[model samples]
Target: MTLHATAVPFKDGASTLFPGGLPARGGVGLKPEHFREIIESKPDIGFFEVHAENYMVDGGPFHHYLGRIRADYPLSIHGVGLSIGGESALDRQHLDRLAALIARYRPQSFSEHLAWSSHGDLFLNDLLPAPYNARTLDLVCGHIDQTQEHLRCRMLLENPATYVEFAASTMAETDFMAEVLRRTGCGLLLDVNNVYVSCINRGRDPNAWLDACFASIPLSSIAEIHLAGFAQDYDSSGASLLIDSHGSPVARAVWELYRRAIGRTGPLATLLERDNDIPPFQALLAEVSMAEKIMYADAPRALSGEVCA
Candidate 1:
C-alpha cells in the first residue's frame, strides 16, 4: 500500500496512473489571448490547463483574468520547469513559487515534464533529455520525492520526446518512468504525441513502443494524457529527425496513436497540447471536439471489449 502525509489520504483506486474518474477532455496551455474569448464564448471544454510558471507573478492583469476564469473552470497546473532530468539538484525557489500558486488557486490536478531545463540557477527554458540509467533514475526519484514533500500533493511527470540516445543507458523509457512512480509515489502524464514522435524518429513501431510503456506502468498511476504536434527536422547530413515542436496541427499518425492510448488508459483526463503556431480559439476547440469524438466515438465497441488495431 502507498503512504500519505495525513490521516485523510489520496483516494485509492484501480491504478496509480488514474486515481479516480478523469474528466476525459480538455484544452492545453490556455493563454492570455483567449482568456476573454473563453469567458465570452464559454467553450464546451471540460477542463483548463495552465503552465504553473505563468501564474507566478505578484499581481497583474494576467492573474486578474485567470482568477475570473478559475472560478468557472476545473484547473490543472502543468509545470515546464522543475528540471527533474538535470545533473544537479532540483530548484527549490521555483518549487516554492509553484507551491504558492497551488495554494492560491487550488488546481484540481498538477503535472510537470520529466525532462530538465535549468542548470546552476540558469534557466535554459527548453526541456532537455536524460539518459536512462540507475544513477539518473535515483536522481529523478529523489527529485520527485522532494517535489511531493514540498508541494504536499501528488504530481505527474511527462516523458520526453528525445532525439538522441546515450551509449551507457541501462533502462528503457517505460522502466525508468515506472521505477520513478514506484519509488516516489509520483504519477505519469503519458504524452501520446511524444510516443509517436520518438517512435518515428527512432525507427521503432509505435504500437510496440506503446505496449512496452503500458507493460511497465500501472494504469492507476497515470494522472492524465497529452497529445501535441511534432516538427520534422533534417540535419546537415539530411537525415530525418522528429522534434516535439507543438507548432502545427495534430499529425494523422499521432491521432491514431492517441486512439490507441485512450483505448488502453480508458477515458483518462486528456488535453490538446499546442504551444507555438496556436491558431484561433475555434481551431483549438475543433481539436478539442475531435479528441472528444475519438474518445467517445466507439463507446459501445469499447464496452463490448472490441479492440482496435
Candidate 2:
C-alpha cells in the first residue's frame, strides 16, 4: 500500500491564484459564526484554518463562503479524525475524502494530531494519546506516509496534551515526535498550549519541555504554531491538571511561551484555536493582533528565553 512521492500538480488556476503559502503572521479558527462577517468585511489576517471534517461533505453555504475566503486568504486544513496513530490501517474512505478536500481547496498548509481518534470503524470523537514506543512510532509513520502520498502535500503533525502517561512508553514525547518527522518527511505544528498543558499536568516545567523539543527537532521543521487556552482542574490526588479545552482566550503564561517558541521558529504561520465558548470574531482578532505584534516586531533572541508578565 505504499505510494511513492510524486508531484501532483495543482489545478490550473489554483497556482496562479494562490502564488504563495500562508504568511508568518497570525490567524484564527474559521467558524460558521464569522463567515458572513468575513465575507462582507474581509478582515485583515494572515490566514484561516478549518477542521477538514467539517467541510468533508459535498457543498452548500460552507463551501460557497469558504471558496470566497479561500480566494482572498491562504487556508490551512487541520484534521481531527485521521486517527494516524491507531493500530488499524489508515481508513481508506476517510483518506479519499481528505484527498478530495485538498484538491477542491488547495490549502496553503495541512495538519493533523499525533494521536488517534478511531478504533475499528467507530470514531471516539476525541484525540486520544498513544505510547511513545517502537510499535506506535512505526504505525504513525506509516499512516503519515499514506496521507502525504494520497494528498500529494506535506502535512504537519501536532503534539497532543494528555492527562495520563503510558508507563509502557520508552521515549520522551519530543524525541518520539522528532523521530516521526524524520521518518515521514512531515513537519511539526508546535502547539505551545499543549506543551503547557502536558507539562503542568505531568509535573514538569513548560519552559524546560520547550527547550528539550528545540534540542531534538530543529525549529526549522516546525511549519506552524498553535496558541490556545486550557481549563484548570484537579485529579484525585489533588494534582493540578490542565485541559486543552480551547474554550477561552489564550492565557498570559501560554502567551509568554509562544514568544519563546517564535523566537526560535521565527514567525511561522501561527493559528489561534478556540472551539468552544466561541466569542465574537472581533475578540478573537484582538488576540491575533497580539500574536502579529510579537511576530512582526523586532525583538532580541534573549527575550524568548525570558517569560515576562
Candidate 3:
C-alpha cells in the first residue's frame, strides 16, 4: 500500500509540499484570475492549492504563472480526476501524467477525492458518489495502493460532498474511509465544509460524522482539512441537497465546524477551496487571514495553561 518509491519517512515534516508544516493557518485555492495578483501582492499566506488536472495539459498560461507562483509559495496538488471509487481500475495514463506533474512540481502535498470521477472509462468532471459496499471499498483500496506506488508519494484521500445515498450502501462513509486508510496506510484529507454540506443534504448529523471521523479514523493519518462553499439543489420530490461546487467562500457555520475539527487535529493543513466564480487573489487571501485568526485564536488561552472553555 506504500505509494512512495523513494524512502520517505512518514515522520514529521517529511514532504516538501508539507515542508513549512500543516498550517494552523490556511490559504485559498490558486486560481488563474488571482495568479498575477498573488505574485505581485505576495500575500502572507501558508500555501496555495491547484487542481492537478488544470495543469496536466501542456503549453498554456496556467503553467506559466503556476511555475512562477510555485517558486514563492508551497503548493498542494488536489486532484478530482482519479476516480478512486469507480468500478474499473485506475486510469493508468492519468496516473502517469499526475505522477509526472508531481515529480516536476515537487508539491508540498497531493490529494484526491474519495468519490469517483469516471465510470467504465467515461470521465465525469464531477465527483460521483459510490455505494459503500465491499466491492467499492476493495476497488478504492486497490486504486489507492496503486496510486501510491505509481506516484511514489503518500496520497491523502478526501471525503466527498455527496447529494444522494445509494440504497445499496452497507457501511457508513467514515467506516469506508477508515477501511481504505487501514488497508493502504494513506492519509486522510478531512473536509469540514463537505461534512456540513453533506449533512445538510443527506439529513445526517454533522456532529455525528465528525465524531466518527475523530474516533474511528487515524488522527495520525490526517494530513489536511478543507473548507469550501456549497449550493443547494432541489429534487423532484421537494427535497434539497447541498452540492460541493466550491464556487463561494466558506460559510460562517462551516467555519465554526472547522474550529471544532481543528480542536481535534491541531494545526492540520487547511485550505479555503473556491473552484468556481474565482475572485481576486487578495480577496481570497483576506479569507485566509480570517481563518488564520480563528486557527490561532485559542493559542494565547491554551498557552496560559488554562483549558479552552
Model 1: per-residue Cα lDDT over 105-171, one tens digit each: 7777778887889898789998888888998998888888788778777788898888878887888
**How do these models rank on TM-score, best leading?**
2, 1, 3
Per-model root-mean-square deviation over C-alphas: 4.6, 5.6, 4.2
Task: After the best TM-score superposition of candidate 2, give how far the Cα of residue 233 lies from its true spot, in angstroms.
Answer: 0.6
Candidate that beats the other on lDDT, 1 or 2, i.e. the better one = 2
Each model's lDDT: 0.79, 0.86, 0.80
Which has the greatest lDDT? Answer: 2
Q: State the weakest 10-residue window (summed lDDT) of model 2.
A: 1-10
- Between 2 and 3, whose TM-score is larger? 2
Cα TM-score of candidate 3: 0.89
Candidate 3 residue runs with Cα over 4 Å from true position = 1-22, 299-309
Relative to the unseen true structure, what is the C-alpha lDDT of residue 73 in candidate 1, on a scale of 0 to 100? 74
